[model samples]
Target: MVVIDINKKYPEIWEFLAEVPDPEIPIINLVELGVVRNVEKEGDKVIVTITPTYTGCPAKKLFEDLIREKLIEKGFEDVQIDTTLSPAWNTDWLSEATKAKMMADGISPPTDDNKVVTCPNCKSTNTKIISKFGSTPCQSFHSCNDCLEPFNYFKCHR
Candidate 1:
């Protein structure tokens, strides 16, 4: 049997969670995605609260499994992962660092205006949307005249 002190264990838990990446955007970890809302420990059980990026996002199931696996690997046998949709998700939840990372990765970060997306490749404010849908549902495909590079724009959320 493994014993863990909740207060003493959070640092390790945070570090472990940092390893779980957003399945769709592997470049960004789920923690950076702002999906992990809270973590608590009740005796031997570890409770994790997650806010989904979208209501019907396909990655939800995968994220649950990944979280469970990660906790188990970290010596937490009784893990309870609770997903909450109440507050819903907004692109605003993304950290500035995460946004910058996305831009650096050639994936256009979300804009303050849901409709107008910037070009990641050239950092051009002048861009046109090719399609509302990009490689993923959460993103839109766009091309920049300045750089002429096609990139995926993170769709602005409500």
Candidate 2:
């Protein structure tokens, strides 16, 4: 890769980063998870800003490391990863396409409104929370009363 104006290569950088999947949620890429907030270049250093799904999330550090490694592998030697909490990360930041992908993968995506969480298995609104936390901190365990199927619901973050 020729070292030139970084602004001109923003799209290419983003496209490359899109291939890196979330360590926990392999079904969705890091971009789809809204983990990657921004990418910028200053001098010869490329800075990447990411927001964790929750405060104190263990995977935050892993995300930073992975991002830095990926950029380095892409020939961006002076890569810097920045963790930002200013705007904060909310499930609402997730796009509709991401939600649909999660639902298709049998993981209920987080919702902005306090509406009933539809079961991914049967699309039933008759679901009860089995636990506030699921396999991961960002998810909750829920079982559908209609289908009697247990599934993980991505908890809404504010």
Candidate 3:
């Protein structure tokens, strides 16, 4: 049996894992989605701690497969992904940088204060909510009067 050194292997795992993008939004990786919580190693097996974005998020299975595949690609024969729901998933887990990227990508980011969403195309504060549901359950549809562009607003996750 070969012994694995976690300190040296974990960074490689992180780098390789970064390649796994979110299925819903391919622009953002799972790490940025706050799905990957921690990475640990015991003996020759690697353990990845993950938190699903939602209770019934379908992407969770894809994420698990991606992690396993990436680790295997990196030559780690044994890999285990552990899902944890404790502490739960909240919008607070989203990084400010990620939010900015979302806005730049024409998707309004979620605000902590539940403020009205601004138009991503025109940067206008004068936007009207069109529908409570957007392209996804986590977003709302809005139309901007300034640019006449309809955009999706990331709903404030509570």
Model 2 pairs whose backbones collide = none
User: lDDT score, residue 102, model 3?
Assistant: 88
Model 2 RMSD vs true structure: 5.9
lDDT agreement with native, every candidate: 0.82, 0.83, 0.81
Q: Candidate order by lDDT, highest to lowest?
A: 2, 1, 3
Off by over 4 Å in 3: 1-9
**lDDT string, candidate 1, 24-142, tens digits:** 99889987887787788999999998888877788989999999999898899999999887666778777789999999988988877766677887678788888988777688888
Deviation from native of the Cα of residue 50 in model 3, angstroms: 1.0
Error of 1 at 68 (Å): 1.0
On the 0 to 100 scale, the lDDT of residue 107 in model 1 is 91
Candidate 3 lDDT over 56-85, as tens digits, reads 777788889988988898889999999998
Better of 2 and 3 by lDDT: 2
Q: Against the hidden true structure, what lDDT does model 2 obtain?
A: 0.83
Clashes of 1: 0
**Model 2 misplaced regions, further than 4 Å:** 1-9
Tens digits of per-residue lDDT for model 2 on 22-81? Answer: 899888888778778789899889988887888878898889888888888989999988
